[model samples]
Target chain A: MRLDQIRPGHVFLLVLILGATLWYLLDTLDTSRRLTNTILVVPLAILVFAAGAFELIREILRARADPTTLEQRDVDEDQDSDQTPVDMLRGVVLLGFTGLLVFFYPRLGFDLAVFLFIFASLVMLEPRGYLAKAAFAAIFTLIVLGGARIILPYPMPTLIL
Target chain B: MLDTTAFSGALALLGSDINIWLVIIPGLMIGLVAGSIAGVSNTMAMAICLPLTLYMDFLPAIMFLTAIFTGGGFGGAVTSILMGIPGTTSSVATTFDGYPMARKGLHNEALGVALMASVVGVLIGYVILLLVVAPLGAWVIRLGPAEMLLIALWGMSMIAALGGNSLARGLIAGAFGLLLGTVGMNTAGHIRGTADIPFLLDGIPLIPAMMGMFAASQLFTLIGSGYLIKDKTARRADYGKVLSGFFQVLRYPVFQLRGTLIGVFVGAIPGVGSSVGNLIAYAQAKRTDRDSESYGKGNPKGVMAAESANSSSEGGSMVTMLALGLPGGGGTAMLLAAFAMHNVTGGPSFIDQNMDIVYTIILGNFAQAVLLLFVGLGFLAIAGNIVKVPITWLIPSVMVLALIGAFAVTGDQAGPITLFFFAGLGWLMKRYDYPVAACVVGLLLGRMVESELIRTWQISGGGELEFFLNRPVALVFAALLVLSLLQPAITNYLRARRARQQD
Candidate 1:
């Protein structure tokens, strides 16, 4: 089980969990020396860190045993066997679009941000459906915006309806 | 248990109100719509309509609210089946098998199975509620924090059973979720993981986080797919298939009964409600079934188990609300508010003096359950068409709806931010072959686990072993938890021994 055999993404996730748990446990201790405050957090943090390390070791062993086994193990229901780099890029782009939509929700407003996000997403996902995409983007934005306005008690920040 | 005079009086009260009958359909529709949408909870719907009930008579108001409760039970299953998004936390387990069925082009059957199970579950829940409300309420009140801790632990065990292929990954995900759940304010007034965010004070909002994990993440993964159902010819929604799915529930009578019983009992416990009931039922179904391997991959029994338990939980929750004036969850809390509005308090006196009213509410829910079958069928007819939409269009549209839904849930930018963050996390977990469901369950139960664990600790005077020794109920639950945890291993060992004998 060598470090080179480890997938960076898997290791990062494991480390993230272990690090977050450790930080949370320490933070709870910082907040209070009371046993109640740290009781569950301390034990839970230890369990997660322990599990994360064990998983990392197992992944390394499995990778060392059969390199392809690690790759096969990583492929889940979300990914197809023939998924290409382009598909991965598309997923990342779609995720980026979502992130930007949330980031600009207060700035650009719900209506405008959502409309632009939908329009851009549709165009990106279906490159040949400009007319349909625009129409859908408009209609969906209107329906969602209108429905939210009616249903939600709180007023949403909006540039225009 | 039957009081003849009260029974007659209940029948008379139900007959006296024509508006009660009129509000049932609308209430059901509101619930169905609210429950189908990812962010709008049935409690929210009922709260929105609470003012409308102020104008109605007491009986009508109660009926209207209960109708919403009954309808929302099945409504959440709609999106859960067609998409992986659970409209409410109660419907989370439903998505395990329901979404897979939709992916496999069995959306109609899944919808049918969920609808029928919900209807029957409500009927069974109310029947048991009617017979045992007084006794059940009394017993539920006796359960302490130690018992609750055990129950939460019981729910947490589902993470182990659901940890698909890797128990280590599952434990990590669940523990991480538990940590996230405890973020914000501890019951002891200590805040741990908020990192200075004001919204973190309430802990991470559960619904928005859930939408991100299950819906947004799943949508991200479906980016390159053409449609939800990959098989082009199998994409159409068939009413006949839905009816077949409806009748198919009849085949799993034992499973349905088990789920309903679990729902009622678990739901009767205040604060636990249908969310945990559905998970426990799904896990039990998976544990007991011969073809358990097919679960989480589109098993109809999984859908049936989840829907039945969650739906039946309404009755279980009502036991606490009506008999103890305690709200089991948010939905029942709204019902309690409605009770206060009507100038009617629930508890021993309310039941003792107004047994007829109690019977009327129970009888009214029975009618609502039966009517749900017909009304839910129409709703499913429309929602089941989601399979026909292309993935390109559906993905962006649903994502936008989910983001807005998250906003609605949180009433601020925090909701969308949490949704996005959890979405990325969920995608990574899903991509790495980790069971996102385990993590979701952890997040859902985390705060409760912490609070209960804290209470149990305080009650025990710093975790003395003598405290558990004194608590018979907690000890029983503890034993059950141990058994539940070991069930998988025991089953595997038995199967292996049987194979050796045959060989």
Candidate 2:
């Protein structure tokens, strides 16, 4: 069967969501011993899973009624084009850069690494003109350092340069 | 004598201090630019610019900040007219007719109308600020937490009133936001959603959360749509039509006056700010106008009504902040925070203690407004040019600015990281037919509503329903909420009756 017709995507999403919810629920319960508070994550996870289950069921019914409807359409539309895996992967990569910066800013230092991260991201987001990209990266780095690094309450990361 | 001396002294100070004007000029320009860009917000502009204020003395600092405030409020209309997208929540009302005007090739005329209305609004709001700051402050200080709670609920109810078409979904989104607010630690010393993340212990970063809900979400959705925003190179309009459009405002004084009143009243309410005021004023103007059917179709009146009230609300909001030590909007809240940093209290006593300084700030509102008028018109011309810049250059630059602004706020990469994640989440929510604006409204009002409900419940010894029922103000607000929730159904029935009569 085609993946969408069998509702594999829905099933996969639901199960993954359920697993994450269950993990969060268990983690909260485990942590609650030290803190006396309402079990918020428990309710949240339940709701999310329940919503996912409902969605999966609805998708299956639609698939059974008209299997052809499950087929992915042409990606010509402006709205659908961005939802493609390429764009998602771009976001994933950008977010990964962000995660790396967040976790290791103190070690590698802020000024050098952040500029590098931003430069890398810009090139990835728009790859063609190296000169234009470099100009953008340099201007962006200066503005952030000038505006934010100068005025913020917290101390800026120590610059090696 | 007090008035003349205050005015003269403030004027003299303005004349002597060229440095203040320099700061004001740049601040106003930034405000205009921020307002013109659809995804860039005035608050974000101000927040990014706020660190610049720390070094300057209080007067110059407040002057620069207020200039940003005034300029940003007026700037949002530029984008709304040029593009269908509104730069700020206040500009949402502008889009009803402003975009339609642009589509009809009266973009310059619509912008001229927006600029004039914003000027009038600033004047009206400031006049009220001049006259009522002391008395209003005195009266509001006497209000307990119970009263504060009622006011907050009133603000939240506007979501149902303004949500248009999908009211239930909006209400649900708002409820969800309220629920999320309760996730963190309460004033009762109980932790709810700590989840081993110590960073969230002080509660979800309010500004970051707002940035996520509105700014990030919008960017993500825009990125996802992948529709390249093609730049148009239309010739600039004749100066005569634009000038006459400016005077067209006076012909519709009722709209201008009504919107101004709504803006001022709503802005005066502590915690409700100009964002909500703009919506309420625009809705009221639409509901009352003779040409209600022409709304959302490029009517100059719609732009006038929204821009006027949106601008006017700032003055009233400032009155609440100065007089009552209560913030009427986010920027004012940040100002209050800044004041707290300096150990200065706001209210009647504050004015009595530092009347000269308070008057300076109040007078600065007038200066900022006048400065904004010149700045807005000039930028409306310039932004028209900037919008023509290649998307390849423009989009990356905006993304970079947004990234830098986000980082500047926290000085940690967490801000930018949060920015992208929220943007993606925002896109998903939009894709899935979830109401992003309602989710934002929910997030915005969540803490106020939760804190109030909690406070009210505590007062009633854990009696939530009884507390709501017993208080006269609360009961009235609850009744209003019910009425607002039922308005869509009520309007639908009325529409049907009108249709039958026509047939």
Candidate 3:
């Protein structure tokens, strides 16, 4: 493929393969194979990278045959994000909230963290008032935790519901 | 071992066990609910629900999990039909024709078709299992390491077909999966890629990784869409259309039979499951059908072929799990782990001694399949409304469910963390047109293939010619593997030649 024809997706795929390969080689060097399947790890990585490299090289031939095909397909792929600005913001906020939930649940306790997450989602996802958000969040938490209490083991964890 | 007396005794066991009977409905319900939701796969559903089985007796626990497995097999089609997003990878093929049917105002009909096909598939699969479990189990015993290695090779060969349109991308994805799956400690007790993190000793958590790939990544893609169903009115449940679609499968016995046969055989192979079966079955149905061109355009037969194959995979998977102690997919792998937890092992001797328990599980699945007709309709009617929920609300809420569900799996932070990492990975794969299914197949089968190869190497002991001989089963499977790889090319070539002749 030409330099301009090389899309970010291709670069990203190459980087990923490289990362996997390096990691496998480094780890295998550090560890010794015994009665285990460790011997196959690096070979597996090599095979994968080889296939990926072969795929990329074949794209070169295909591009030569149908010059526009590669560029058009790459553009379509790179355009996966079709959201409007407002919609895009909403998605970003949701992803941020997920990160926060994962980071804080252990520190905040499951019920508190989960309830907060639900309330925040309700408020941001729609134009609900504060009382409505709180009510919705409360009901959701109660039902979820209440059922967990009944079905799951008790003395939950870290004062979790 | 599977004489008439054993069959009747198995029936008696199933009838006598009210506990097993009661859990089947609940299990089916749980599976249906979990599966109908976006991002929450049937495998993740089983993994999350695994803890619940801790309280039940051994037989009841296994039966309950199996019911979830059975119920989950069909539940995913609901989302695939009504919503464009597949609830699980196994249901991905359903989205091709199913979503089109729904968009064209045949939503109820599509769902009904999926339900009917799924039920018939399961019924037919179990019947095949019952007939072959004993003999197959005995035959598999003779398979040896050489044969098992060939089976894994066969599974890997299917990855080419899975790449969607490109064999190169599929092989790359599968290789990535294999490497990722091998991150944990080798059988020799030496950790390979733990990065010094203690939890990495088990490698990345499979269930969490799957939730990320199937659920979170898909959710990310959906954040731009206003509604899952554009017509909006199609979101509502129409009982009349559902019933009509349900009976539609009866009109296509041929599709049902072909799909079920494909599901059973493919699902029986370790490391290969419904994902490949559905795709292959749909491809074959399209290839042979008179109205082939209408396949991906809301054809009921397409829906039937895909759903039948996938649902039948549940039985096919159970065959290897119960008979050979081999897991065909993550769900069956979970079953094998449950077997260990309950101090129950399933193999030739186990089945021979506990023939009644074996029979009970199969019979219980049959009951679950019949029960699914009612339960699934109610579920589709209710869960089908998910299309009405906006992306803003659905995305975060699903992430929350996934987080909690992941936390529940590991009882620690590793689950949620892995969920985050894989979500990003899955999204990238999706965005780039890479088949994440190939990666999942690689992950699922990686360990099995590696171990089988090692065992084969040891047993062969540098005498390749001797170990390779005297194995008729291996030879047959080897032929099947090669044929499966070439069939697509053969079919495409013929189609092209026919077009040229016409011109």
Cα lDDT tens digits, model 3, B20-110, are 8888888899888767664456776677778778888887888888878877888888767765556565787787789779767788899
State residue A158's C-alpha deviation in candidate 2, in Å. Answer: 6.7
lDDT of 2 by residue, B1-503 (tens): 15656656667776666666678888888778766654456666777777777777667777777787788888888766765555556776676678667656677788888888998899888887777778766654555557666666655664554443434334444445544555556555565555666656665554444444444334333433322232243436545656767898988898898788778866777666666667666656655555666766667988898899889988888888887778777768767765765667887688666666776777777777787767776777676554344433443455545555556555566566655655554545544444555555555555566666566667876665665566675566557556655665688789899999999
For residue B407, model 2's alpha carbon misses the true position, in angstroms, by 2.3
Check candidate 1 and list the clashing pairs: none
Better of 2 and 3 by TM-score: 3
- Tell me the tens digit of each residue's lDDT in model 3 across A31-128: 87554545577677777778777866665554455445555555565564675657647655766777787788778876787778877876776765
Worst 10 residues of 3 chain B by lDDT: B157-166
Arrange candidates by lDDT, highest first: which order? 1, 3, 2
Superposition error at A134 for model 3 (Å)? 4.1
**DockQ score of each predicted structure, in the order shown:** 0.68, 0.21, 0.45
Candidate 2 segments exceeding 4 Å error: A5-54, A67-126, A151-153, A158-161, B1-65, B72-117, B142-147, B154-176, B213-228, B234-262, B275-310, B325-346, B349-364, B382-386, B464-472, B488-503
Instruction: Name the best candidate (by TM-score).
Output: 1
* Candidate 2 chain B worst ten-residue window by lDDT: B224-233
